[model samples]
Target: MDFLHSSWLIGLAIFVVVFVLAQSMFFLVKAIQRAKVLKFQTSDIKRVMVSTMIFSIAPSVAILLGLLALSKVLGVIIPWIRLSVLGAVTYELPATINVVEGVFGQSIGQRITDPVLFVTVVWVMTLGVLPPMIIIPLFLKRIQGRVKNIRKKDQRWGEIFMNAMFLGMISAFLGYVIAPRTDAVTGESYVSLLAIFTLLTSAGLMAIIGVIITKFNKEWLKNYAVSFSMLGAMALAILYAMLGVR
Candidate 1:
């Protein structure tokens, strides 16, 4: 809570926590892909993971700096845009935080199915502490993976950069458009009850869909899962909003 008042602390904390967590997920995914492609040498897997984790940190550093600079520029040049992004990001915190906490506990899918806990957590998680948690980590992992592995896949850095920008832009666009619509349906007025309900239902469905995909393809949906989350959020919001304005 106190961190909300300190932009510098907020930026730093988001970088450190989300970068580490996202890098770990990247490492885990890479390990799985490696296992699928080659023999499971524990040593090779561990060595690659350790190296990837180290490499992943740099992009996150760049991203955090960019976010901070964005904040500063938007704050000074287009003050309202800063407030809007902050507010939109703030509105999304609860679901993000709960997801992260649950993921850490390996309960992400389980909790997403619980309407009551999910809603309650989303309520608490907002207030501006949690949105950046998930958002930062999601973007960080994607960017770092793209950066480090561009050469692995014979890809170019410019392409990777464009893709990373696309993801961030997509996330923000989805959040802005989808979230408020869900908020309207929520009827909570102050916080939007429908936001959480729609959010969790979508997340739950996504996890199920991901599992279905993974059974055959293994690690296919691991990275793409994040973008689907945005789509899921938007779909639920539209469905709920179709009911009527709150």
Candidate 2:
């Protein structure tokens, strides 16, 4: 059996994907039913669902790009299963590379030919991300309960806390993008100005959208603004690359 494209691997991938769809459908149906019980209009519920679907498309496409990148080395099955489950490309790629380079002294660009190395890579990938799954299940409810209590105590502070968390995440990503890197083409040390520009472009567009939505009461833009901003920022990144911003 081919380790990369075996029939059993494909079958397992299918099963996992199907399970994800099934679980989402279950929650969707429950949400709609609960909305109805709470006297939400059908149109409102449908609008929310449609808006969510629209908002998800851009991020889903980004994930697909990540899947494609990883597919070059790991093939389709492992990345497909990982991305379909809880693993993001940001985490999975680094975890795989760390194990491969640290253990085998090889780059991910090189195809992993040894079965033992492949198994080791898989184990590292699995174990590296396992803590989150265990911790979430064991403590997520308690954490959420505390958050809810705080929110109930002071709604303004709750909002501030959420905003702070979001800003923290954004700052982390910004720091990552602006970190120094060696130019692939020139082999010179430089910061990723293109990524920083792209990040700022996306944020600017989002802010503009927010202002437009608030000032003009353009409620419809709320659903699609994020997708538009992301795509716009990506387009700007491409143009910046063409203009030698990298």
lDDT of 2 by residue, 27-124 (tens): 99998999999999998888778877877887899899999998887888889999998889999899888878877888889667788888787788
Tell me the TM-score of each prediction against the true structure. 0.28, 0.86
Query: What TM value does model 2 have?
Result: 0.86
Error of 2 at 125 (Å): 1.3
Q: Model 1, poorest ten-residue lDDT window?
A: 73-82
Lowest lDDT sum, 10 consecutive residues, model 2, at 110-119
lDDT of 1 by residue, 98-145 (tens): 554654343332323344444454344344455676888779888777
lDDT of each: 0.53, 0.88
